[model samples]
Target: MKFLIFILGPSLLAIAVPLYNRIEPRLAGFPVFYWYLLLLIPFGSLCLYLYDRGRSDDRRPE
Candidate 1:
């Protein structure tokens, strides 16, 4: 379960690149593909953050 959450960050990349591999739409003068990859930084961090938070909870006394 927790392992799956950790995988979400990379899994998103594996699943998303092909879907966003285009330049038709632009953001702040940047191609959608470029900005989308940049945007993933925080999103992927959030996924990893969530995974780490969940893992910490598992280590607490219960």
Candidate 2:
């Protein structure tokens, strides 16, 4: 369902990043842990923004 997707999507991304680091040690200029850790802030914010936007868009005019 949409609700499940919205909640789980970000969590999956969070988990995958670390898994990716384990598979590929270097990303850009940093180690996988550092890269994933740095990405957490922006990725989390983006997920929250998308969740809010989806909720707003789902509203129907009354």
Q: Please report, in order, the local distance difference test score of every candidate based on alpha carbons.
A: 0.77, 0.72
- Which residue pairs in candidate 1 collide? none
RMSD of each: 3.2, 3.6
- State the local distance difference test value for candidate 1: 0.77
Give the runs in model 2 whose Cα sits over 4 Å from its true position.
15-24, 60-62
32-59, model 2: which lDDT tens digit per residue?
7777768776877777777879889778
Could you tell me the TM-score of candidate 1?
A: 0.71
Please provide TM-scores, in order, for all candidate models, with all chains considered together: 0.71, 0.55
